[model samples]
Structures are given as C-alpha cells and as structure tokens.
Target: MSGMEGPVLVVPGLNGSGPNHWQSWMEALIGARRVDQDDWTRPDIDLWSARVADAIVAQARPVWLVAHSFGCLASVVAVSRLADRIAGALLVAPASPDKFGITARIPDTPLPFPTVLAASRNDPWMKFMSAARWADRWGARLIDLGEAGHVNTESGHGAWPEGLELFRQLQASAPAMTGPLQD
Candidate 1:
C-alpha cells in the first residue's frame, strides 16, 4: 500500500466528534487529524472556513479532506479558495441549516476536485432528500444510507463499516492530482 501522501484531516460537526464518533474511527484508519478551529462549538461559517484553510495547510500537503457535519460545511466553503491545495475530499453529513446563518452561503456549484457526499436518511441534522439534492447540486456522488440517524454515535453508528467502505471507494475512484512532476 502507498504510504499516505497527505494527512487525511477529519472535521467534526457542531458538537465535535467524541471518542465513539465515526470520524474518530476514521482517524484510526488513516491517521486523520481534526480541523482545528478557534471556536468549534459555535456555527460561525467564516471563522470555521478560515480555520479549515489554516489546518489544511499545516496538517498535510496535497491534503485529502474528510469532513462531517459543520466541518463538512467549512471544508466546502474553503475548497473553492484552496483549489490548488487539495487533492480530493470526502464530505459526510454536512450541517446545512436555514436559521444558523449558513444555508444561504452554500454553493449551488460542484467542487473542482473529486468529491463525494455521504448522508443519512434519518439524520436529525439534515433530511435525506435535502442532502441528496445538495449532492446533486455539488455534482457529488451520493450514498443514501437508510435510517442511519446523523450517522454518529448518538445514532448507534460508531465505527460504521459502510461508511468506511464509502471512504475506500472514494480513495480508489479518484487519483491524487498532486505531487512533483512524476514523469
């Protein structure tokens, strides 16, 4: 297996992932580090994006971002500005809210690099159909997981195998468009 090129950074939702959260499991699999933010608990999009960008630069070169909930939102917002810096992204359970001052900011466009959106059908944070629609808008491959509430530990989804399979799929489907000129 190829040694990891860049650290796979994991971004948690509003509350952040606890020990049992799926993102934590992902950290174990790929040596992922969280997107460090100044204020993690608050849903401040701009600050969150800035933190993501900074963390992306510091954590790994040619970074492959893996974000969940609010973290996913932060990544999406920053990726367009950091296009030249990223290889690919794996966004899961993005926190899109109409009242939290972020819903209007989400792009109706697809991200430049290879990307995927894994959403749950019964997530308290997002409706399945709405998440699928966002995926369609962003031109991301959508994996509709049935009844996986929020796809977090609260939903009884600690270390989800299916989600991990989806990550493997993303890694396999897309080639990293990074590194020095490898002739």
Candidate 2:
C-alpha cells in the first residue's frame, strides 16, 4: 500500500473467492474491496467486466485491480476503456480465454496500465504456455509459479504472503497519479 494512492479492487473468478481464499485474505489485510458480480457460476465476460468497470468508476480515486482466474480476463477487458483511472494491476492464475470461448473478446494489444500476470505450470484451467502467450500479448510481466495449481485456496494458498509482495511490486512499478479523476 506504500505506493498506491487509491482503493484496491479484488475481482474473483468462477464461484468467486471463498472466505478462505487468498483474495479474501488480501482484502482484509489491505482494506481492499471486492467487486461483487451478479452471477458467479456464469463466465460471461461482458457482464463480469461491466461490474468490474463500474466498481472502478465508483472509487473516489484511482484503483489497483487484484484479479484471479476468469476474473483476470474480465478485469483486463474492463480496464481497456478505463485505464486512465487505474493505478496498476496484479492478475493471477488467469483462466484461458479459449476454455471459456471468449478468446475473441480479450484484447491482443498491450494493456494501458502497468500489469503483472502470474501463471502456474500445473493450472488445469490454462496451460503454462498459454498464460505466457497471453502475458506477452498484454505486455504484462509474467511470473512463473512452477506447479502452483491455480494459486487458489484449493491449491493450499490461503493468506499467501508472496502474492501480497507481488501486489506491492505492482504498486511500486505504477506511475503516480495526481489530481481528480476525469470523466
């Protein structure tokens, strides 16, 4: 939180991060808010991204997105048109766009804000190489987690300190924002 000048929004994927999930822990640890979606079972990028975008817009200042799995995909899409209000982003264990049949919807160009994408070699939702490719496409810095399964609570990653450090790094790397947010 040292370098962050605004709220941190946590976006969870699929069923949404449970109470024991790292996203929940991070939210409590750093006073971050979660972007609650209307439907967790459905992987509708349009609906999910719209919720994320609205959450960011509602923030009084710039925001940093901490997104996981399918939430990562939605977050990127949500920020595409609102990058100026973003401080940065830390995307972990992003689900494959192909798996959800939304590959065409995800942007192929670099993200407008500083971003870090963490990927695991053994995540069932997406191949390691596929994550690497997406990272490259988004011009995000990729971190290899080496066998960490989805980097979720089921993978035994509750209260993950390393992930917190990564978020800090993203904050440090983000360019500082000043003044009021523009409409």
Candidate 3:
C-alpha cells in the first residue's frame, strides 16, 4: 500500500483539476500523471473514455487510476478496455452521466480490477444513493464521505490526504498481477 508498482493516472473532472485541486496535489505528492482530455468543459463520454484507454496503452507499467467527478465515469468506461493494464482504481465523487442530459453509459458488468467509489452525501452532482447503486453494480466498495460537496477545492479540500489513504488500502487488498512491468 505504501508503494505502488506502476504509474498513477490522475483523471480530473470538468475544466480539469486546477493547480490547487487535490488531484494536482496528488500529482505533486506521488508523481502521478494526468489523463489529458481534448476539451475539459464540454465532456464527450466517448472521447474521455478513449483518452483514459490511450493513457493506459501508452504505459508499459501497470496503471492505477485516481479519478474524480466525470473522470470517474470515463475511467469506468475505459476499464474494460484496459483491464490488464489497470492495477486498481479510486473513483471519487462520480458525476452521473445522466446529469449531462445523456443516457447512462455505465456498464452493468463488474469491473475487471478492484475499485473503490467514494461518494459525498451532499454532492450536488450526484445523489449518494445513486453512487451506492453504481458501486453495487460495478462491485466496487462505496465509501461515504459525509457532506463533502463533490470533494473539490470549492468544498474546502485542496489536498485530500484521506483519498490517498483510500488508494493505499485498495492497493494493499488488490491481488498482485503476474506479468513483468513494461518499464
């Protein structure tokens, strides 16, 4: 849990994580790389999914996903495509695809890798029950973060160290993959 074997892919939500966002702090603290989306404000589900998949493909080593908001949805979509490359995932404050006026694209099947879905009780983007439903469907563990307001800087969490702790727990519990790292 203390040390992960591969690159930590930091995926942000709308407008991308600002310099002071927790995801950015994670990058600074653990040397994670951001999944670059072509357009941050206007999120296209397919495009975001593709970007996540591409990031995994580019990595020779195993990749651990640290995704927030809409990025969590994209990472979920990309998981099946990059299952072998993913070590585990931390999905924080997932923004329901339905909120964007699009029909849900979430898959019904359980994810290939172990995952944790962190939900905020008072997040405007999604209801806690909806997140719990998603966790059930994806077979992910749901962690309730009470009244955390989307777990963003606007919610008073510029550096969410607790999220890092959750990632560590996931890593510790996940089964080890057998293949050699790409480098």
Candidate number achieving the greatest TM-score relative to the actual structure: 2
**Candidate 3 worst ten-residue window by lDDT:** 174-183
- Arrange candidates, best TM-score first: 2, 3, 1
Q: Write the per-residue lDDT of candidate 1 for residues 41-153, one digit (tens) a residue.
A: 78788888888888766643677788888888888888767776776787888776564776788777988777889888878788888889889888899887777777788
Alpha-carbon local distance difference test for all models: 0.77, 0.93, 0.88
Q: Is candidate 1 or candidate 3 better by lDDT?
A: 3
- For model 3, residues 6-45, the per-residue Cα lDDT tens digits are 7889999999999989999988999999999989998988
Question: Could you give the candidate ranking by lDDT, starting with the highest?
Answer: 2, 3, 1
Clashing residue pairs in candidate 1 are 123-150
Please, what are the lDDT tens digits per residue for candidate 2 over residues 3-117?
Answer: 4678899999999999999999999999999999988998899999999999999987889999999999999999999988888999999999999899999988998888899
**TM-score (all chains, Cα) for each model:** 0.89, 0.96, 0.93
True-vs-predicted CA distance for residue 26, candidate 3, Å: 0.6
Which segments of model 2 are wrong by more than 4 Å? none
TM-score of 2: 0.96
After best superposition, candidate 3 residue 154: deviation in angstroms? 0.3
Q: Clash number for every model?
A: 1, 0, 0
Residue pairs clashing in model 2 are: none
